[model samples]
Target: MRLKILGFTTLMALLAACGGGNGGTNPPPASNTLSGTVRLGNKASSAQIASSGRLLTSDQEEFVPGEVIVRFKPSLSVQSVSSLSVGGVSLQRVRALGLESTGLYRASTDTAGTLRLVQGLRARGDVLWAQPNFIQRALKTPNDEFYPYQWHYPAINLPQAWDIEDGTSSPVTVAVVDTGVLVQHPDFAGKLLPGYDFITDPRQSNDGDGRDANADDPGDEPGGDSSYHGSHVAGTIAAATNNGTGTAGISWGAKIVPVRVLGVGGGTLADIADGMLWAAGVSVAGIPANPNPAQILNMSLGGKGRCADSPAYQDVINQLLAKGIIVVVAAGNSNEDAANFRPASCSGVITVGATEFQNARARYSNFGPRIDLMAPGGDVQADLNNDNFADGVLSEHRNDAKNDYDYVFYNGTSMAAPHVAGVIALMKSKKPALTGAEALDILRRTAHPLDGTACTGQGPDSHPGSDCGAGLIDAFAALQALDGGGGTNPNPDFTLSLSPNSLVIPPGSSANTTLTVTRSGGFSDSLSLSLKGAPNGVTGSLNPSGNSATLTLNVAASVKPGSYALTLEAAGGGKTKTASLSLAVGTSAAKPTLEGAYVIACFYLGNDCDQIKSRIIQVKGQTSGPYSFGDLAAGDYLLFGWKDLDGDKDVSAGDYLGAYVENGQIALVRPSKSGLNFALEEVQGTGMLLDQVQHALRSLRSR
Candidate 1:
């Protein structure tokens, strides 16, 4: 909501490790060597590689009996070592290698010809990288937990769907691209494989070591305390199952790979981009590959921009998508059009919007044609228990200033994005064969479209049927769709055009428009058309005959002139098509425009004329003014007026400060402006009333 200016220097330092190291005055490539005793599966004799290059056996651990890892010196290649005497017998030829988990002679090589060989072993079946597990500990729910009622459910229903398919057997890896995960949490213990930290503040690490993950520059302070944005997200994805503790994850059997990108304020685009590659198991020249790779990448943070089409960001995203990784991003929180933001706006990534538990769009959730699906982002302020005020939602938060094992409530699209990510993991677990795009298509096709204001129609209206991109997402429907048929067309062909593409009509005015629908196939009788994004004070209706439909609307005089989109849907005969119409409307002729210097005096009046009391005055307005009245506490208000001697309406430049009027009455007779002028105080009793009235007038002028 608020933009914090960040120093570029800090960003550059965080991004330094992202770039592959190049040859120059920098130190030569380090040797890949390990000097330690190797023992067999049983505690038999131990084999050691001494500094003299002789392999000797002792009672400690044995290397020759089983697979053992051996590091070769510089300039030596695995291909040259065709035959080597292990236990006095020449073994098979050794070749350059990839990776082995943790046995003897597991071979992996660096670009400098240094080889790591696992002695007496060969590559076999695929290695399953486990998700980060969470350690569940019970604490009295904190009083500060926001919106506790919404989080009342012990374990959501979707994870149960995963259990039906035995999904936890081979846990899927979900990368939490936020603050680092609490590896020590009871729910996350042993589940967290090795991961990297790109914060560059030199204070954050996978382990609590002073050294960075890459042994490069010191990283930033892992700002874990701000919010458990990552931990909560991880918990939702894979917290560990049947531990008999708190809530269960969508894929309780899966693991989490904590990729710390965001920090104190937030992370940069570069850090996020690099984190994506690392999580997907993409190899970089200098840094060691992720000890654990992810099948699904969850990004719950986003900024405002059309990032989907940007080449700089898309290139990296495309690389991951190509690797069969489902990238889920949060639609922003601005409650504006989501087509204007990055990551979410990108085509390949699954962009998720938020809705309340009541199945309506969250008041603060952003929407647009770009939104692929919606999930429950608790409306903390909603009167879930019939209360008048919003209590907060219960979630994981930064426990303390140090950002450790603390958990609290946090409500945002950040909280909602993980729900969908975890769902995707369950989907993937059920149907491991589904590709990223196929899984996304299934989720969208199966989601139960939310009805009412939550849906953004191509036209203006807050009602259910007038919104956009279907309705609220239905997890049950999504799983069903996955089971029925996995994939569908990512891009479909359909065209919708509207007349009077843009217009500005006064309040209480009406306009007529037509939506033309064209499809690749012939016309059909059964088609459904809906409108979204209607400006305030405007309403629309559609009259469908055949292939064409007429949309009629009247704009209220109070309607603000702005751009709006009209989404038209044509579904029939087992297939559906979507299109949008853009519209604009002007402000009302008699709309109140506040001007000049003023002070507000708020009041509450009872039904009877006899009861009136002063109330708090809060301001909300555009940036052109000094304050915003929108943030004001509730109550009616009056404003005090000041004269504009120069007639400028504003007290600025060379204007003279005129006398303040307590009421409509003032020494100046008949002020020239409409809704201007004050009556003289002939009765003392009316002075208080005049003061309130004058305050209201001043408040209007200030706006």
Candidate 2:
């Protein structure tokens, strides 16, 4: 995705960082041709590209097809693992970094097979999880640059990281899926991979061609010199460090795959999504497959939008996730909620936001729950270093007007994203199996928290995890975490689900499920429903009104003969609930279906056992104790009592903190014959997190 240039201020002084000079006198263009609303819309579109390389289209925001996730019971058996291969089908395993036995799979590219595989897998007693994956995406937010002098690297402790993992020992490549790069730039000398240009619309291509092998910067400015944005991003990722060059990159030994999907007038949803797929070595219909696939994709560009609206883009990202490619996106420079931006808010991405020289959230950097980590994007307005020049991310820039390359300071979440991508490259080099989800877990655990007003507040303001993300990216700590981390999971509500679960529809026929909601914790708040896995010619619609809705699917007569698996995800009440059902084309007895939503919740107790927090779960017919708990929060408890939910410090509705407490053990549960008695009055919890949990529990008690 491309963002029109935002105006920059002048104040060039000494380029101490790069041992260079000149900050320039010219100001950023007085005005931008691309409006904010339209540009944001474009970012959302880029993630889920339509086949047509157009900017606006009705079918751009759909979810990925032919995908599903299944959680198996704990201490898994070989028989269960081997069963992934259905009798007459092939199940491609994506990632397995969730819970102990959770697996993601591309059951079938065809709708029919997808359904059968899911149905068959769920039929197995060992599987424990299934659901839809949601996804969202933005650019460097802007500021002054001095070539080769990047302070952001030090902010994240890159020097220490380099000593531990310079990425030289392994062949690591990161895809810069943006405006393309300048091949001749010395910073990219030995690091450039032969990349592809996915911009099909010649008008946007600006090179008088479409879908060519050339992946060079043709420029994205309307009537000015090229911004060299991709080149800048590449420089940050793997610029030649200690090579006596213009600037040093984060992962010095990593390679760069400069894929171009944006041009003069920005990018389209389809072109960008397709470019990402192609970069990951996934085959696109008309384009040639990428021969040198990358381990990471750094998207320093994006737009504002909800993940739900861009299901198509979400689908592409889920595929990337399955392939274990770490997708890093800029949190955007909107200065608002990153959760509203595409890709950043989308599931499974490492969303990076920018911090200034003072280690505070950048004024323009978007902040919210969606941010995964923070990095130095720089500030051109404040010269805290007394360098006269604004402290911006310094990298390679081409001044076509002067016919020479220039190194300058620039600010934006865009700059921040590359910094993260570079770090991920280093991590991927060490742990070959590092998925985007795992990368985040490590980043969060090791990040240096931005507290003490530097970037700590609540909502619309700065707040760790929720706003500024896990804090400033720490290369050193992250590397340390790589040595220590493993598990990753769902991060959500009135729990909702659909069932009988699987229905078979014949050609030219239809099926329906009545949707229902399960309320808890006074989740009387409004609830809504949406769908993600239906294929073409299959019309899936839902009623927007009323507390209860119906999801009706109509299959056209010309539809292919096959089975389809559908998933329902309920996110609310501080929890994430998901379920799946199968759809097949067969002459099976039909029944009017009620899309039912239900839940069962529990927590593990005992200091020696792994304390699982509230998922508020349960299958319809599961037993109240071990059966409903499944492999979840399973462990030994010395006493019967209530789960503390939060640590003794706070009460928890979901998973943030605490556990079940029994007789003041802080967390435990004592089952009562009269249904079940939840004794919240005596449980002790302290802290803001607990306060919220207490309120939620109170609501549930009254209900």
Candidate 3:
């Protein structure tokens, strides 16, 4: 599943999706007795959110309405920017940041106008790329919960591993990039860092605001079956253990960063990317830098399609990897090729598959070469262990059904991924500077052979999954591989990576990225760096202060025009590491005048014009070219666009349905003339058609 555009289809059942089963057991009595809202499927109501406030069929075309994300060529000047208008519709630039602050603008238009707006923008020469903000779903399988019954930890020898490196000191942060969490749960009290809510849509956030500092779980179910998904995933990684609490986590002292990405309707690809990047301390526009940067990111969410389909995700993931942040993802639960799902299929991530208490691949865990290792992700359908409940991994969650926060059991690659993330926490705690690549290599090298049935293949894929990673993870062995991780003496090693791997620089200009060093084993040595394969007349300089340095490159105006691959090498204490950088030297061609460009309401609204419903505004006016709508009553009115994407307007398919809008809805009134032709009040945003419109378009697209 490669994504050419940085987008995703609406997320489906996450790896931790709840099957139809009464979740086993309920939360034990809490010490506080006052837990707030949060969940993964254990007797759970898996309400994966999509946040699109529309009613469509199972196969709905959902995206933020009245908005389009456009990446303009860097050469285009801000002065050359203009509102693109087509068929009486116009798009106004709402906001821009990231992508090196290259004019990556989110444009806004009126409701029912996304289709026309996207077409207009795509037709322009200056626009490098354009796409609607697509939503992504959480990963986790639904299954019908107690901590004593948690066999997952011992299954991976975590009990012994704890004695070696329990993370009592030098605790690192593991970012849970999933649904929001319940900050008040006793098990998580003092265990959470100040995380952020990256959900940008109010409806999806269910918190009634855009991105903010609050990272608490508001519940994922709009109709009441909310799952505190993020909370569950967090507990598995850092639930307060031996505190007379419910369950024991892999890393008891590790801090959890709750970067909420999934909400009412799961999460958007845009929000997910931002959340992951922010977790690693990358700057996201309109959001503060993360004070508690994570050493690892636990994404128990994903969607179908190739990883390449979403360049945004790939770019962000690369950034995280370059920062030495370990990323762990669920291998999906479709019982098929792990390569078929994203994030898991993406490179540089530790993709984990599920194994039951018996040490065999769980019935639903995806398999294939993409899997880095297997971990205990129980089978919730049957009580193979005779525990009197479902055979699942135990963890704490916000149990709304029990009207309290308590323990529950769930099973999926979602469960498996966190176990690895927790192990990473322990590793990083032992070696504060362990790089992501080093962590993966250690895990794979220390892994044990599969103990599950077949020992070779699982899932419904075509061939035997002999390539399902090295084998089951052995936590104790992994810690031992760290060599004195719990001891004062350790092997000394260091890693280097360059950020913004690719840079586009205009001739005679300069660009800067970052070079970071991660030193392990308490090694303290002076560092020196140099670059290879540089073009003539191009010079680079930086001062290494501590573990980071700013690498600035100046290209002589005489340099040739082309892309150059450069290698950055770092050396310290008789150890060396090499990283790559991409440099492009050229200026984009000038843009031609826009044809039939109709600038809409570009006045007072500014960027906020795209903040809400700028799409398909409602108003009735005279049949004139310029519609100030004189003599029109101030009463609210409905709009009907002449768009039937499928060429057949059918109400059942939600074709051209009047947008469900109110409260000073922006009005798009063409001349009251028989033919519709009027300048819009220029909205500044981007989005796909309403889900209703998308529902019909989906059919047309399939054909």
Candidate 4:
């Protein structure tokens, strides 16, 4: 649980809203406009308006938000109403306001209205934004995202990469140790076995009066709030796919065991330690015995501290590994060296880092000697499609209140860690007898070297030494490496060399070089030549395939000049040999003019919603239509705007926002004339209110 200082005004307002009113002033029946936030012990609900001048008691069977209405009349002259009854069913009374004698209280058959009323009472009128839970939706593709299951000359494209292989009947169980899982999610419905909640705060672990399992604390948030993070993580590992709904996950066939350890903000090392033990099937005091033991444990959370090889933490991790369970942890997102984080940097567990779809290290990923493998964490800046702008995954977060079902795009090592875990599950499913070391070897050996860099102890380009273990993980290559024959060296000895050794080339210009190879151990066939290093906006290629290959490199006129190295490799006899050459490139003084409009579309909380016309901004000096700029230096830039498109002061989701540079250079297109059009999309739903309550309650206490 986390705690925050509630300002005096906010605190007074809450007290007055809940306690100041004396019974009988007979406040007018709460108005249909009656909207407020309700604090349940430590947890708070989203702000909602009473629909049809009525509210539903918590126990009503059909009260859905925006669908139902029920009203309560406090006893006259009563200090406060403590309870109320509806349809013969009694519920704890909520602080009532907005009563008018002439206003007739009417009840609607709609349950959504009642839910809205309850939400209003919980939020106290302040509505926060909401987004969809992405993690819950993305966990459908278990192996395809991490491992290539079959081998083909060029790799065959299948309708769905994640299809269950025949003859695989066994199912594996993996424990998700973080926030609690949404066992109720359609993807995980029946698959979520009973689990334990070790959160010390009673208010947060209570589980919202849902099903009774081994144990339940209100949750990490003091008042029974659930951390969507855990659910997101769990979804990444075992969300069912092909259900014709949301995103896909990695392990569609696997079962998830939710072990709630960190709550609200986070949990202590001790609680995490306990959670680990329980997750690994180890018997512990005070916890109900796990009826179903987990073979793999997915821990997507960690702290920044040197790995303390202390007997306590080590013993717990070691025991799990000894039992044949592979533990996966995230390489922290601090962007600092990974050596600073504990457990992740600790031995006995697989430490994973983030990479973009292109297999490049994520700009924010932590790098160090300890990182074992890299997986697709998606780049916020890289154009996922060739559309020319960065696009990636967007999921639900615990931030928004009003549209709690909405989701946003977030990039971090946290997203990368689970990809590795899901891949492990696929390997386990393929070869159930594979040991942890064997599985690690399969994953590491198959990784594609980033930019032709050697996979020895030395790191790839940009990252020298052991920073990026092996290189970028290649699902296709790893599966091929498992086939055995590829392991044999194709070429024994054939060295290729490049000239200019090192020289600068201007952008948009080509540099030609000759490759000379000396044959020794064997005769070389046509050599398959490839160029590995060049900065973004620069392109390089090898000409003439054979023992003697020619090299041609082009640096985009907009390329940012920088020092780089490329490796030229020769192959024959099932073996490969490589030689490196260095070069420097300078960017062009000219920038490509950019003028385009993008149709902004988005789905929030599983709903299609639009608020675009209000948010689009026109660049200064540029007309409302398409426009462009001339030459500009290579550097970072941003676009900014805020409902100001219409000169409005408030910045709402559909409100126009301008862009401003956060980091990096905009060289591919004209920086000066380049302009980005904004299209805003927002998700809608009430589920976000649940997230807010959890966050608030968690903020009120310490775990």
User: By TM-score, who's the top model here?
Assistant: 3
How many clashes show up in model 4? 109
Give residue 52's error in model 3 in angstroms: 32
Residue-level lDDT tens digits of model 3 in 336-454: 77886788889898999888877877778888868888888887777877869888888877667667887778888888899999999998999898988778877766676553344
User: Which ten-residue region of model 2 has the weakest summed lDDT?
Assistant: 33-42
* TM-score per candidate: 0.48, 0.52, 0.58, 0.44
- Number of the top candidate by lDDT? 3
Per-model root-mean-square deviation over C-alphas: 27.1, 25.9, 19.5, 24.1
RMSD of 4: 24.1
On residues 461-510, what C-alpha lDDT tens digit does candidate 4 reach at each position?
25542465555554444444445523222223445665434444556777
Q: Which of the two candidates, 3 or 4, achieves a greater TM-score against the reference?
A: 3
Between 1 and 4, whose TM-score is larger?
Answer: 1
Local distance difference test scores for all models: 0.47, 0.58, 0.63, 0.45
lDDT for 488 (candidate 4): 22
Error of 3 at 73 (Å): 3.3
Residue-level lDDT of model 1, residues 180-284, one tens digit each, is 676666666545667777553333332354213632112223432345556777766666555655445567667778777665445544455556777889764
Distance from true location, Cα of 677 in model 3, Å: 34
Candidate 2 is scored at a TM of 0.52
Candidate 3 has its poorest 10 consecutive residues by lDDT at 37-46
lDDT of model 4 at position 243: 67
